[model samples]
Target: MPAQSANSTSPAADRPPAARDTDALLRAELGTAIRKLRKERGLTLVQLAERAALSHPFLSQLERGLTRPSMPSLHRIARALGTTQQVLMAAAAVPHPDIPVGSAHLVRSGEGLPVARPGGTARMLGAPAYSVHPVEYTGMSEEFQDYYDHPGDEFVYVMTGEVEIELQAAEGPRVHVLGPGDSICYPGGTPHRWRAVGDGSLVRLLTVQNATGEADRHHS
Candidate 1:
């Protein structure tokens, strides 16, 4: 064997920086997190760009913190990285508080006005990759409509009551009736409609899309 190196035997030689500027440290940490997640998922920059429907140049800038991503853009990147917006946001340093009831951001449909659809509510929780929210419908007569489309896909899981979903496809329409504990997924490009069923409130947990795309309108 060759002679042992002095630096190789030193533990401090391989240690990370103990103190850094807050802003610079945050940027470095965010960059490292993104790079780590990307590598762990075996995706190259080009592949992640394709998945997020974003230009490779923009993503490169984001990776270097030369460009700051908006919430939607961050969500897209997280999805492409096989993570959640909530996780990415947290890694970027958003603060959260704990209370006696639980975390303050726990969302329940009907507690807040609907952001995308009417008659129902959606709460967004966590970073993009690890975020979750609960949706609640007040009554069966309530029919919710929201227009959305993205580069990735979505899964809707019904937790209570029932829902009638109609997905608008290039060829035509596909209808699905979902009950408690039932779930379904479709391409992000498919425009869709949702309506509550039966005589009680409907509840669902939706895994929202995290890609870039224009919303499509469906009339029926």
Candidate 2:
């Protein structure tokens, strides 16, 4: 199949009407994440803008998702929020499949809780999150405090655009470029990172993290 185009119709269009409301969905998800994190840190919009080196109005626009931020701008916001870019990326999501089979929960298109750091929106498929200081874990997850090595499995499936997941091995390092529908999974201890593969076009993924013996068995 051809590589998915960023300017093309959203993949969600082929799914259901509930998924078609993507533009607004993206903004709501991103805005909600920023607002939640800011409140958690007890910093008002003005203070956060100052700390982020962004203007108050622009920050407000960001919180409202009226505009998008470049990756560098997101990095600044992450630092100002006392978190990592990856954490903010994770803020766009929350999930743990260990609960049950068929819970009937639904996170709409581009409607994942904002991972605390800042980036693409995310909704969890499985694997719960850990708690951190100064940032309480509310029932509605929108961000992570930080990432640590823990016992669990990870699976990231590219749904749009392109990505490269680099993994370390005895031979040295390896890179796997994934397009839409491509996925990679690794154990918890394996160190890895995401890299841009092409035009740095926007990419989305269905991320699954499972911390259970069953998942180990499945992967093994």
Q: Among these predicted structures, which one has the highest lDDT?
A: 1
lDDT of 1 by residue, 99-139 (tens): 33333443322222222224443333333223332233333
lDDT for model 2: 0.50
lDDT of each: 0.51, 0.50
Q: Model 2: how far is 30 from its true place, Å?
A: 3.5
Query: Where is model 1 more than 4 Å wrong at Cα?
Result: 1-94, 98-116, 128-141, 144-147, 211-220
- Local error of candidate 1 at 140, Å? 7.4
